[model samples]
Target: MDFPTMGDLADKWLEVHARVPNGFMKGRPFTQSDWQFWCTANFYRVRVGAEFVHPDDATDENPVLLNQAFVYRRAQVVAPQKTGKGPWTAAIVALEAVGPSVFAGWAEGGEVYRCSDFGCPCGWGEKSHRVPAFVYQDGEPMGMRHPSPLIQLTANSEEQVKNVYRPLSAMIRQGPLSELLLIREGFIRIVGESGDDEADRIDVVSSSARSRLGNPISFAVQDESGTYTTTNKMVEVAETQRRSAAGMGGRSLETTNAWNPVENSTAQRTFEAKSDDVFKFFRQPPAHLSYKNKRERRQIHEHVYKGSPWVDLNSIEAEAAELMQSDAAQAERFFGNRLVAGDGQWMDMPKWATKAAKRDLPFGAKVCLGFDGSDNDDFTGIRLETLDYYQFTPTYGAANRRTLWEPKAWGGRIPKDEVRAAVEEICAKYNVVRAYLDPQFWETEIDEWASKYGDKVFVKWPTNRITSMWASLERFQGDVYDKDARFRHDDDDQVKIHVANAVIRARGLDPATEKRRYFLGKLTDHQKFDYAMSSVLAHEAVCDAIAGGALEEEPDEYVYF
Candidate 1:
């Protein structure tokens, strides 16, 4: 770990000048939490007596710039919503505006920093007003105010920028920060030595304004980067700010809540970036606890909300429970601090997880099987639903059970012989009441199976029919979310992964019913949802069996294989 960070000076400066922007402590001195202090310390970690130089510009002779002076060129902070990120961002902006924000040199000894020396009267030697002295120990690194700092507080919209700008305005107006800076509507100007001149300024920028984006900046704070996606054009804005900051040898700070992985947002890209000079801070909850379990969810809340003492666990629980009713993934992402696909997600993972059960049906139990087939470029799988409503795939037979087959695993083509053998083995192992086969690329196999197993047993079930497909999906979803329904499935991870990859795609309104219908679609071409579709077909088969009086009949005698 690196030592002698200028964050010590920053911490003291915020405490002396900054104030709480709102709530009960509105006008009190601002205090950094332990987590905030850690962020400040790491972001300000500097190479002693060194200057920043771009790797492209470094030659064998550039003395100060040759060394990787600054440990990090940029940094990102990921935390839960309302964890004081806005106020922390404001404090950072304040520090960059007038505090010791740049590298000066090494401290020899006995060098003290007093406000009086910096054209201010807030010092011990002053007649009524006084401030504490920051003594520089021997061999310690020193910091100085930027010569002409320019900072931008930016987001996707003006309202989003207020997340940072509003707190900053209040901080300056409610505390001693006012003496050093003047806060207007969208600008905070630092007073220069002449009292009337502007030394530096902080501007509020959004996606709507791009004129002043090219100006050289000392620092920038990008708030809510999770929403900075290419669709909103905030991705371009973030890239522009990085270039602007780099021009002046400055850096940026990105603060955001957890992001949806499918959106490919700026925060997601930043986290996935492999650059060593980018510092990332993300504290996820313990993996052992399942977010679907209500008891474990409270524990997860406690873990992720550790540093934020002001957060109320009971209040968070209420809000999360309510939000889970509509958007389970969002609740987990916001309160559980977990990255989950929220937008356009077809299935609520927590609801699906709640339906997970261990396979308990006896051997040779009457069951319905759903089959979806493909030759290549996709997956082929079978799902089983017992007469008692417990769903599972046969994992105990020979030949790897052959229940789930992926073309990629087998020379880019599904082995028809292996699939035939597996289907026969399943027929011999269980008293199959009904089998719904998609019969798209396997028409010949379906015709042969219908002859051998009876046409009523192996029926053609085409998934391309949007109307029936949508109805089946709706029924499965309702069963999963309805408390009164007893729908359950085997704890299969492949099924869960496929379900998570599924997204909703709406087709036009039905001609007869005049109601909009939707079906499951993959988030991307490579992310397969075949297993999830198979599960839905399996549930639909079970419903048909009950309606046709198959499950109502007496069970067949058990036969040992």
Candidate 2:
């Protein structure tokens, strides 16, 4: 029961068991491979791409695999579709099945070494790299102590695990490593061992967080986690895995591509949190690369795709161009290795961020209001925009742009009385030209609002159909993209979250005569984009007010009350 340095273990796997069953190296000899997680004798490093790359002292060169005490409990692996993610995860599973992957506790004073000079795996004779494993004598951290750990490959669906599991199953059955294990339906068992021997078996499960109940899994893999969401019982599975592995030193690995903001996948949460416990590795493309700047975009593509040299660049470019015809955001997420919201996004977030500010209009100032909400499971909101949103150079890179403008704000959820009072107060204080209320769950209240503020403001803007929703969304998109349009926000967190969750979709569209106009909505029903909708409504009302000559000087014949 001895082991060597992780570096050597990787070498042994490549030499003995690992193979390129498919791709350019299909049927060819195994080659050298490495993980982005760097380790030295006393330091484990996270390569956070540029500037932030640093290795901390501790968990040094002899890093433990699933060494809970010495490593992050979870690792999030994000890369394009075919950059060896499957092979790498499979390799980990293979080595974990049998290797000195376990930690041998703290080193006592002298060195502890176990030589691989006997019964080496790399077949073609003797190899130089993998050898001299360290044996545990006493008083050492027993890392990966599970000699036959129960590993599970969990995905949102069984089909998703096929890419990783199929190749993994093949590597064991077809490769020389089959001597160590046996593959069967619903189980990959250690040779000659019973189901009771939890230490040396792997299972592939899909969905159903309930299936993992009471199971003590030594390690788990969430495959293609970008699609694993709250709806698919991902949150439940994650919690279950952690609870099951609690104190037993169980660990999990997640592999996924960039997810749409609407998806709100577990991978998105992990990457965004930047938690200490979750080790993340991503080859992200540079932001601010203008679509017009083809050269910069190409360079970003080259840099992000350097890991996949075997993938044809010419083919990628061609495919990328073709994909752009449908969804450029998807093309970026896959080919450019960029973690972006999907093509259904209503607004460019980076463009939207530029308009963020901290401003409040005077209580008596002329403005328009937007109201959106639901009965439950979604937030209710009210937002105000000035009567006129003139175009200006947005706040680009903090260089004297937007010095004078006040940031717009989203009024958060409150009681019905507060909402009504706020509406009445705003109408009384400001020359409220119009109010657009999405009358879904609040039809009665909306009718009351129309009666209370009908003369001063045009208040009935129901978002029920094609004409109503499209009008608002079209004007909003223009306000976002056009430098002349003014649609700024007060940098509210709700605005960002709600907007981030919004996706552009052609709802209730006709195939033949009428061209499809997109409206902003959630990526999925569970995700809420209320604030975004309110913003759209606010913009639409402002446009209406403007069209009604709200911004024009009153004629001498016009009388005021």
Question: Model 2, residue 542: displacement in angstroms?
Answer: 15
Give the per-residue lDDT digits (tens) of candidate 2, residues 441-541.
78888888777767457565677677668866776877787765566667665566677778777765545646677666676764678877777787888
Q: Candidate 1, clashing residue pairs?
A: none
Q: Top lDDT: which candidate number?
A: 1
Q: Which stretches of model 1 miss by more than 4 angstroms?
A: 48-68, 124-131, 194-199, 343-561
Model 1 over residues 232-271: C-alpha lDDT tens digits? 9999999999999887777899999998767778998798
Cα deviation in Å at residue 539, candidate 1? 28
Sequence-dependent TM-score of model 2: 0.57
**Candidate 1 lDDT (Cα, whole model)?**
0.81
lDDT, residue 523, model 2:
63
Per-model TM-score on C-alpha atoms: 0.61, 0.57
The parts of candidate 2 lying over 4 Å away from their true place are: 1-71, 108-145, 156-159, 169-179, 184-186, 191-199, 207-214, 229-243, 260-276, 290-300, 323-332, 338-344, 353-376, 379-497, 503-520, 530-561
Maximum-TM-score candidate: 1
